[model samples]
Target: MAQRNRTAQGVLAALLAGTVALTACSPPTSASGSANSGGSTKALTVWLQQKPDTASALLSGTYGNSEILSVTQDQLVSVAADGTLEPRAATKWNLSADAKSLTLNLADQKWSDGSPFTADDVVFTLNLYTNPAVKSPLTTVLKPIAGYDEVASGAAKELSGVKKVDDHTVRIDLKNPDVGFMYTLFGATIYVLQKAALSKEDPATVASSQIWITPGKVPGLGPFTLSSYVPGQRAEFAKNPNFRKPVEFDRMVQTLVTQDVATQQLSSGEMDVALVAPTDVATVQGMQSKGVGTVSNEVPGFDRYTVNQRKEYLKEPKVRQGLLTAIDRVGIIKSVYAGQAKPINSSFTSSKVVKDGFATYDYSPTKAKQLLTEAGWDFNREFVIREVNNNAQRQAIDQVVLKNLQDVGVKATIKPVDQAQVTDMLTKGDYDIFLYGGGNYTADPSTNIPMITCANAFPKGANLPAYCDSKVDDLLSQAATSTDEAKRGQLLTQAGKLENADVSHLWIAQPTRVYAFSSKVTGGVRGGDGMFNMLMSVQDWKVK
Candidate 1:
């Protein structure tokens, strides 16, 4: 997932200084040499901020890895540009009459090594993910599978819910009917791994072994094969000859280029595609005017501040609501984001999945003061708002929040901490408040709403606020298992209202994703969870 960081501003400033010199260099030649050079473009070059930790999709959650892994591995399903579920390895699927089980007809496909892609591979992938030895973040997504607890507890070696009906078919029995189950299959967290290649080794070792990280050694069933990888540097991929469809580029290269340097490279034609930061949207737009192609969309995530309810001073709901009311989210969007973000007022931002009956907390310092007075909160104590040091946007928003709270007779200070420390601080209740943002991975509220649920309260889960509510938990649980869309939406709306009333999170804005590519590169699609799915349609990409 793309993290909003303050370093982007510094990166932009540093890169701007050398933009003239970098652009002064000769324009980069096409992958297929220049028309005058009598060579054909055979490769596409892309810029990523960081190198992936591992090529195995199940082991890593970084978007840097997904850019390469999306082409190198095939998922059971694929998410379309509009966020609809589409078949990939699984050609077609049918839900049981009761909706508690799903049967999928696997495509007649072969791994990059020519081994048959069978139902065994799918079963193995599921079992491997559910294995207690492997601490995969994806374990949560597969928890709905029947017998998942036994499998995760090491009491069972295989998941009873997953069975191979035939060589080309697999059935998954869910403990409860989940409408978002298909979406889970299409997520970057789940991808098929060859059973034959991995079954011999301890499942835990496979994720860390060179056999999985090594470019040519990793078995994949996608349109490309990893040719080479250099940590924190670059990765190279060659087209898979056994791919079901034709791929336009013969090879793809992903180079690690910071946000500051990416725009300069894109403008100078040194890079084919790069994600443009919100601060750099204007610069990229200027490049677009000069024929630089661009793709923009709303990613499935939102920026917000989490109020730590565990704090004595913030234990009152009125204090949380007062703070929320005091902050000017719209003004922050305009000043910090430069009007590049959409104001959000609830936990669920997507209208396609959840309805919009959430309570709104518009900016009003007078109302905030009134609430504080009623709550009997003293205006003398200095509250600390911890923000990650790398995110310039959050830092700007922090300053704005500081000023807003001060105006409401509350003394607040901004505490800048390392990005890595924010989570620990939140988990330990070391901070009164913090600013954070990232995707829920899936559009369904069940995937993200749990963050504020009692079960996920701090130390054990991501409920940074240490918030607990039985009604909210019940609403989310009902929303997850109900097959009725209207009923589910109603449940989610109720859940959102309960959380907003508790002020678990002060909903801010939904940031826009912007990507810049050279005119020669075609077929870019922005899909689920930020830019994780940007290269999901790489097979259709062509360079003219």
Candidate 2:
């Protein structure tokens, strides 16, 4: 594959030549670490249509949950909806002896400022996101722990895959043998962050990620404790009296939903939940025809276009399967998500390589001009794609897929770019296709097999089609270090028959994670996976 796009363009020109001051890759935010809305505690208002500038102190640095106010949800480790792994703040863990390694133990943690959740706060958030001056997005999901690539390339300063076997035990160690390494340590980027509550002052709040956009102290142990988050109003999260309250909810009000006017703010009792859209599920079936609320829909996730094989007519795999037979993934999931999406046949959904009854695309602009005239990629020239900012419904689904690729003659357009220039134009292979969306968290393929086999598909993973195939990267490095669930389900069924017969993603449509709650506020559908799994323990959440 042109030596895999010249080794992912020379490891993304050496990780963007370690971007020594181009001054804009942004990401240093929390907008003043929040909490504090309805005075003396007990709130759970919640509503987030995704803005809090996308909060990610890497889920409170490893396993601390809520970031650090004396950890709770009974010490955080919950992941259910049938994928198992329950017990937050950890009251269990200890695997090794050829099972790879794990060890944890914690029990009744603490740290929302009182300290003592130890192993030096998980080796200080694994030496602060394997620090290169904390350039963390959990450094591409903790770059396969086990000496996190020599402490993220600075040739180890610590973190021989985190060790500390004492102060509340710790032992992680797994550069291989990851049959879902306890389901990727039930993600939230494995939470844990503390090292003396972010070194209590001077430049070293994890060395200035401006201590999350200049907010003061965001340390948590979950049961909500945030004090202020006003970016379009409301983020409050009280009741962390060093938590340990179940049936959960002590207080966790999120509220920031910038309207999709689904109408029933948790059934008109003034905000309890929201995310109805499919043009508001017929205003939530007329708020379930006035009896109140409950709307369950499940498809879960997929909405791709990531065709930057390294630009230019998408480095032709028949122009990325001729823009996946020029979209219409079921007429844009039946008129732009009016049915709230579904089509995707493979990228190996819910693993065991999902193929029940295959054969997907059928929108045919005469079979997308006969697969761009059998791979020569024809007159159809519509190319300018980069928009992700102010996503007016992905600019109205790129103005209806650019009038259906200008009615087959092609020549499309959409340069939107903002949200930090869509994460450095999809990690600097600049962009010729990026319309993205791919959250399947842990339902497998280690999340859609890293969106199709492609070994870190160059330029630091998410393989933007600099797609290589050393036998599908030795069967995706033996399905990521093997835990042998039937030999990692026959190597993810040969990496889903080499990712849906190599259509190399244009799959689009699996979607349904819509969330909205407020029927006198009570938490039930509570997240374990997909459809916000009821916002994964939105903490002691209440209103009625």
Candidate 3:
């Protein structure tokens, strides 16, 4: 999945200056030519910020783990470089007239071990991921499917909605209509596991086993197969002979290194691909000017502070609106991101709703004070804004926002906490507010609109604010099931307006995610947000 928040502590000045030596330990450079076969000598060296904790086929909960696991697996559908749906394992698909069922036509392909790829594999994947014992994030997103609740709650071990129509076709029945259900299958987070190889183990407990990391144990359908993985140090992959797509490179070598070290390695040509941090954007642009490599910038999501509506002072809409209005968003963008970001109001950035007039929450101290006073503001109470303690950039920005709130007669201060504490606070709703970010990976409005629904709040769903409004919920429900595009747009626009009016969250700026790639690499596609989607076309990437 495209991550919502990517907060990390900034590196020391000594590290950024490259005075303190750190090694990526990249593999020996190969000849400068393309490799057509697995034995051919062409190779690519990639750098990741950290080592993946787990490479389980069931859970891709962390950052670097998703990319490592995704390259070795194939899903039913993949998002193209142009942000449109493209067929991968499945050749094509059709939704029923009522939009309650979906049918997929599988391609004539084979796993790495030469087993035939059929509808049975798809059905197995659905049942495995939905099993409550597996504790996969897919359990929540796939809830729209028929019998998903039963499977997710441990009431049933198998998903009754998924069925194999034939050797090459599969049918999925949904309990209710969902127009954007296909978008949920974006290959970044979800993947099809080999049923022939994995069916022997308990689906609930297989993720903890070493089956995925062991070479040749888990037969993959991707262009490359895992050759070796050394936990925190490095991982290597070789071309898969049974893959349906063309493989341009003989092998891939992934090295785990920090962001500061990655920038240094890319500049020295030790690494072929590395993600560039916002603080090092100028340095990479300088490298680009010197013909070292290229930099790609994308805005796939926005940052914000999720408010807990259960708080007495925060329960009122005016108070929440006032808090957002007082913040100097433009100033923060300039100081924090160096003018690389733009102030965003709505989470649905790609939709017409944002451009057509969603609330901007423009900085207005006077208006903010008036709104706060009208809402019976509690002057004696101090608001604690919780965030990751190690993030220097976030703390600097939060300090500015805190000052803005204090200037408007609001008592507020920043409380820095670790990642574990942040998670606890969000789950228990134990804090006044917390910093976070998120955005939909697909173009459909249903992917985002349903996130704030009442049913999705806290214990029931992942809604951070725990907000509920019957009007907003109905609008989103109608939009998701509507067949008319115009009607869907109208309904979504109305829902966004209501959500913004209620000030469900204090919206912030949309940061531009940057990455550095060596000039010798070509055919690379920049997918949105995280590394998983960004490297979806690794099979087509070539070394000159």
- Report clashes for each candidate as comma-separated counts: 9, 57, 2
lDDT of 1 by residue, 1-544 (tens): 2221101110111111101111112233333333223245377777654445554555534455556667788888764434456688999988776668989999997899988899999999999877878755445557778999888787898999999999999999998877756554444347788888778877777666666558666678888898877666666778898887778777777667556676887787777777777788898889876568877866555677777788788878888888899999999888787787888766654454444555578899999999999999989988888765444556778889899999999978887765334435655777777765654333455545435668656544445567778898888788778888898888877887777787877777877768878877766445332334567667767666
| C-alpha root-mean-square deviation, candidate 3 | 5.6
- What is the model-wide C-alpha lDDT for candidate 3? 0.67
lDDT of 2 at 8: 15
Q: Rank candidates, lDDT, best first.
A: 3, 1, 2
Model 3 lowest lDDT segment of ten: 7-16
Q: Write the per-residue lDDT of candidate 2 for residues 236-329, one digit (tens) a residue.
A: 5556665545434455554544444324445654555555556666666666544455546453334566666665455566656666767777
- TM per candidate comes to 0.84, 0.34, 0.86
Winner by TM-score: 3
- Per-residue lDDT of model 3, residues 1-544, tens digit only: 1241110000000011111112344433322223222454677777644345556767533445555666788878765433467788888999888888999999899998888998889898888877777765445567778888887777887878888999999998888887767665452346788888889887667877778778888898888888877766666788788888778777777777656776777777777777676778888888875445654555444567778886777879889998999999999988887787789776555454544666778999999999999999988888888766444556767788889999998888777665434445666777787765534433555655434667766544445677777898898788768878788788878888888888887877777767777776875546444455456667767666
